[model samples]
Target: MEASGYLLSGVLTGLFLLGTVLVLARNRNWQHYSPAGDASGVGETVERLAGSPGTWIGGFVLLTLGLGLGTLVVVGGLPVPEGVQGAATVAMAVVVLAVLAGYVFLGVYHSVRYRGLYRSQAAAAGIWIVATLAVAGIAVMLLTAG
Candidate 1:
């Protein structure tokens, strides 16, 4: 279990880092493509970002990371320091919550900003919500299991 947890953590971390880099690269490409000015509004920005393959892949990576981390915690495989396990767990929970909040904010902002162009916002938000909830549920189980 411990070995599996460590492996999962490493894999998840790599995926998350890769996703982050790809997203940044996509943003840079966007800037180069649109040298004139910034995106018009939240809607346009979200649309552009969401339309990219990188963004979609990155979203999946993040979701996987959250789910994997939660599973690790619940399985009692996370190699957190014995003395700081509670603090570590709380910190991880906070990070997962923040990611969820970011997704919701993006979806709501885009929907509100571009009522007409709110095409994929719902889908994105739904995935985020589901993933976040799954992670939260697992984390809760982990906390209570002890």
Candidate 2:
């Protein structure tokens, strides 16, 4: 149980870090077409990345992390740290919600900004945001009861 909790924590951390990097990559045109400024082939490039298998794979990874974390918390019977119930639970929920919201905003903005590469990439990001929120909600519930 402890190992699972540790694994889940690591997964969550990695997902957060990866999401951050993906946002930056889109913003900086790092994930855009190679030969950066070439507007001609940009559409094709964007389309490929947006619908790439990699995006789906990454989304699944995030979803798994969220589910895994929630499961670990339940199975391990971990209690919320003292004084972290009620409003504190609400506070943690808010923080996690904010993170998920930020991810969504980033995904939408990036999709619109780079319409060419919008589909796959944006879907992948969106999935992570949704998964994160779901897991965060469960985490808060578990913590609140403890």
Candidate 3:
């Protein structure tokens, strides 16, 4: 029964997105598209960020610290203090969301500041944000079910 509810929710969300995409297509909202073009500047954005020092190094350092702490908690059974035991999980979630937002913004932020992009980039980003929000909402519902 629980799984069925999730499936139903997923199906409804899928249908909604399909309808949205169809409407957007009919309206020609998916513009500025280049199947094989090098004008989006997104590649340069990524390359610019990657070429800087400490980009990969900082990420790996954080990952290593998180893994080490997680291992200590699970394997070593380290005792958490009275309060804020769940702070780590909440902080991790925030970090994940921040990273996701930054990545998504990267794919669309050039519309206002650079060429080869327009409303289409922003529209695509909007669609993705909506879909992700819907999925996250359903997941939260399932996880919080008592």
lDDT value for model 3: 0.69
- In TM-score terms, candidate 3 sits at 0.46
Q: Tell me the lDDT of model 1 at 134.
A: 73
Q: Give me the candidate number with maximum TM-score.
A: 3
Order the candidate numbers by TM-score, best to worst: 3, 1, 2
RMSD of 1: 17.4
Best by lDDT: 3
Candidate number with the higher TM-score (1 or 3):
3
Q: What lDDT does the true structure give each of the candidates?
A: 0.67, 0.66, 0.69
Evaluate model 2: give its TM-score: 0.28
lDDT of 2 at 139: 66
Q: Residue 75 error for model 2, in Å? A: 34
Model 1 regions lying over 4 Å from their true place: 1-51, 115-146
